[model samples]
Target: MLLPYAKPPPGDADHALLPPRSVPARSRTGEGFYMVRLLKSALVLFIGLHALFYALQNIANIDAAHGALAYVLSGADHAAYPATMFFKTGNPLLAWAALAVVLAGELAVAFFGIKGGWDLFAARSGTAEEFHAAKRSGVIAAGLALLVWFGFFMSFGAAFFQMWQTPLGTGSMEGAFMYAMASAITMLFVSATDD
Candidate 1:
């Protein structure tokens, strides 16, 4: 059979696993790559460090922090909460457990996010293939950040703690959603392969 070009087409059986060009993920130097890399790195660090700071600050005063958490859990003066059984439980153990999970997640985000940013920075001078390969850390970091804000805070705080029922509770939800979206969008940007 005749061929369209000298080599097999990009999606053909012979080239399904190969790049059309020499380097698969490498991209030509351009403004878009730098912009995406910068934005992704900043977003990862921004959310990760912010969560770490929150966890660190709250650790010093567990009693006060749990007091606030309990307040949010109770839905404040709002009567629209699903139920109040958890509030009546009145166990510091549960609060401590929640605090521990959040703090751990925060630390993970901070560590992974920083590592991802460093990887990207170090690869800036290398080939686009190197930059693309270095993005693995950033991807993991961004995922952790999203999980911390959305999976942990939004789900646990709003569902378990009923944090979305009151002004302060709602405020927490808004912040969580914001961080989650920022991390998500940054992930999308960084995941884009450039020529």
Candidate 2:
């Protein structure tokens, strides 16, 4: 009597007999969405607070009949106006540059908050598949986040220069630190995600 035996298909035996390959599963939970939301909120709040502080400071100077720009420019020339060690009347261009840099940074922050919030909400509501399909692009969100971070760093330099030249009160210092923290946290979150 002859025994009949069947040969396994090529590659099938190798793949099937061997344990199935296990890939580390990625999470698509609401936790990630929540984290991004918190970060966005903090960024917006910080920008608003900082802008308000600056506005108040400028208002105070104007009300006091002291020329804010003159005070900023003429570092040590005006005895009534405090001298800023870093800024001098000769460096008017620097002051303007700093102002422009900060304005750009605030705008970038706003853009990020809007886009990130939209993405997070869509993802959390279980519409990620639809959202991803319509968008077919993470470029906008990623670009906004990058721009915000870049602008933040640029503004940090300008703010540092301003603080060195003019006295930034405790409130300003605290706000700056908070902004820095928020930026760092947002960057970390953006970098960790696949989308």
TM-score of each candidate? Answer: 0.73, 0.43
- Top lDDT model: 1
What is the clash count of model 2?
A: 2
Q: Count the backbone clashes (under 3 Å) in each candidate.
A: 2, 2
* lDDT (10s digit) by residue, model 2, range 68-177: 33343344433443534454554656555545554554555455445544554455333435433422122343344344434443243324234234453223445555
List RMSD in Å for every model shown.
8.2, 9.5
lDDT of each: 0.72, 0.44
Global lDDT of model 1: 0.72
Residue pairs that clash (backbone atoms under 3 angstroms), model 2:
73-89, 86-165
lDDT of 1 by residue, 1-195 (tens): 854656546667676556657532225546675666666667656656776687788787767778766676445565785566565335667666766777788788778777887777766656767778888877887888888889977877777777777787788789889988888887887777731
Candidate 1 runs further than 4 Å off: 1-32, 73-78, 82-88
> Where does candidate 2 have its weakest 10-residue lDDT segment?
130-139
